[model samples]
Target: MSRPMNDPRFAPLNLALEEALSRGLGSGFALGVRTQGGERFQTCLGLAQRVPTPEGLTPKHRFDLASLTKVLLTTPAVLALAAAGKLDLDDPLATHLPDVYQYDPNHPVRRVTLRQCLTHTSGLPAVEPIYTWGEGKARLEALVLQKDWAFGESVYSDINFILLGIVIERLTGQSLAALAEEAGFAVTPGPSLAVATEACSWRGRMVKGEVHDENAFALGGIAGHAGLFGTLDAVLNRADALVFGAALPPAARAAMLEKQTDDRALGWQIRHLNWSGGGLSSARSVGHTGFTGTGVWADTERGITWALLGNRVHPTRHTDVRAHHQFRQRIGNLVQGIFAN
Candidate 1:
């Protein structure tokens, strides 16, 4: 709302995005950029909906935020627990959830530490049809953890955060949604400003005002890997916190940024070439992406926080998601150029 989505200052970036939209990238785009100086710029354009009922995208619209939930909601909760002395990063999953692999008391998976999960090095498969496994969070969780996980190098897995979510719930006696609400992340099942997502074949309707991830929806719409809805402000708030470190204890902040892999820190991705944070980002910067065509990047050196939220999955998720990543990387590069000048 700071400036119209059609603001000319964003014209250069929007020109590229508009081309993507024209070629069926998504219905619309919304972006927010803020600097440590408190400078703010926001722009949104295109339609928020293209079927049933049409609506235009706005800066105020709440995006599905998809896997961004892992960083914005789940990761912070884990950090809080660590800061509170409820847990340690090196502790195995069994330390918090003793029943994770109760089927095998000596299962190596029980030794998968929190740090490994935070860095996506837990050797878990990248994904699974969790919803198809069964109903109820407890059932899905047990199924997820009890699966015969193959061991290997680091691979980003939704399973990692899903387990982390369960761990947090077990530790705090709170649901992920409750933690999100308490954290003031602006997440909700149905915000009045919600943007439409895919017309799910399984659900037999256009997905809007609810979770888009099938597994998340099946898990009751509030899991560790997905099912967070928020506006640009929520993402920016997270980016802001990353830059300022004002809200985290010194130990927690340090632990959050500790490198656990060549390209990853605790819950964030270290900037690398061809990644969504763009090739131009400083080495110290970290960022994350969501399956809903949403992402947030923070340039710690520049003290900038940027969030790009869009409904690229709207009407369907079969669109060119790779192109959406291109949009994110290109826009990230452009944002860097603007501030560098």
Candidate 2:
């Protein structure tokens, strides 16, 4: 399914990524584009890290795949578990994660369903500083279930995936790292070879080859929401799986890409107005982005999957978010042009 290097079609993509590099989207990036027909190509450019001795980027450089873990790992893991008859998507989270506020059966946390969590309608806050509050991963995670914060309409929450992680572990009796490794993630990339993301004030050093999310870092460097590091191929292969891999039941795979709620699917977000996937994204397209400036989008209708892996947070994350979207949109539309015929 691999194409020869230097395909003429990739020239425009190279120029686009080069322009992004010039604009400081990231010190470096690795992008992969593949068609369902098995045509594949990539463009890797810029420096992986700007601080310390400079290192040039290469296709082998693993990037910290931040929130991509939700779709590329957690959602698929949940589907696989369901296919294996370990759990049901409609089952309450407490059905799998029994310790989720177990003391009070009447707790609202007990009523949240796995499907609701997958669809980001679980009534949990978008985020909480569980990392700052607790001493241990277990204690911090337990706070998510027990914390009596005001819950309103459903919101995207890292806690949802954290709970999903707990459920997966409880059901499989295996660590997430082990499962992630099996799922084709390079969970523990060497710091020397991994792309650097930030000059973290908390960690007192440049964050490279380690997770940047404070909560995922606090959770012993593995969580359902983040802490995944992977190669560009790994990201693309998973995107390929979501679109066509038979590893999950057809119904489960369909659910992952279809609109499960509003514009959101199980974990991926379907293309919508003004979405970063761009104007060219068809209704069958789904994608997700990461805090570390990584993204993957696949269009079933177009038979194309593309990923952009970058260290946009390097040095700092205090940049205009809109600019990132504009860049992604520009590239998404351009990628679509490849199959316009």
Candidate 3:
């Protein structure tokens, strides 16, 4: 049977959501929490669209997941390949794509390992205007392979995951979209639930029902780092399985969630001891935040997970930005309160 949905501990969560709406932190949001006992709490707010039209935001609306795409699509494929022994975490970037290394023998990127890429220690730049380069995947892959390595830095680079996504595609002969569906996500139809991010001068169109990230959009909306769309429920369902390893054997799940470096696992970000503003806290917690104001964190310690979907990029990406940090922290605090009682 499914878990019950009523719990007094969740009261603060509802209050938090109400407060966020009142403060204009978000036009709408979809939050879901599943406790260890399987109890569930879900709340939807505001409109998917700020304009009061027939097609404004609804409870079932979908928001751009942003960087969360890293764990949702890229990470899982990497794990599958690792489990099958088709890839090695310690293997150097040159081993997989040598052309990228030939550009500069001294390139620090050659020393980067798959594990480093997953853990955000690859020392690669966080982002690049790859879309403006007018190069195909092969050239982009080469460029990434030649990056300078900054080992031991907490630098998070989308290119690292983007390259990893390419590796997954080459190894499995499958697109990330195909893999995500196979892993159990139902893509939204007709862009109805999906939301727009920006009106790009380069793309010459208002980005909606398509990827908002320029790099991912250039890659055709199915890259390792970002670019995929779906309903809130679909994302949360997959996250539940990945964090708890409930869908896999106990040993396999443990291996996936096992801490490797300072609260990082194979593909998920583990909670750190000194996280400021409670950035996804909990011993067994794992989750990712998207640049589009979307985030999800699951606490294995409390058997609770929270998925917050918002379009802070809506209308304009340059609105009052202070709300983003506050929203994230409030969401974390609200989830922690759910387990306090």
Task: Please report how far candidate 1 places residue 159 from its true position, in Å.
Answer: 0.5
TM-score (C-alpha, index-matched) for candidate 3: 0.86
Q: What TM-score, to 2 decimals, does candidate 2 have? A: 0.96
Best by TM-score: 2
Sorted by lDDT (best first), the order is: 2, 1, 3
lDDT tens digits, residue span 119-180, model 2: 88988889887788876788777776667756788888888898898888878899899988
Query: Using Cα atoms with residue i matched to residue i, what is each candidate's TM-score against the true structure?
Result: 0.94, 0.96, 0.86
- For candidate 2, the 10 contiguous residues with the lowest summed lDDT are 1-10
Per-residue lDDT tens digits for candidate 3, residues 1-341, read: 23333466656766777787677666677777676776666777676756434245555666778787888777867777777788887888667767556768667676678888888777777788888866576665555555444454567788789889878888899877787678654332245676656566777765667777888777756678887675677677778887775555555567778888886787677777533225546666777778777888887777787788877776567766666766777778767765534
lDDT of 1 by residue, 1-341 (tens): 25444556667887877787798877888888886677778777888787777787776788899988988888878988999999998999999999887899888889999988888988888888888887897788878777877777768998888889899999999888887776555444573678899888888888888899988888878788888888787778766775466667878887787666788888889887678988888888888998878999888778777888888887878888777888888999888877644
Candidate 1 lDDT: 0.82
* Model 3 residue 140 lDDT score: 59
Locate the minimum summed-lDDT window of 10 residues in model 1: 1-10
Ranking by TM-score: 2, 1, 3
Among these predicted structures, which one has the highest lDDT?
A: 2
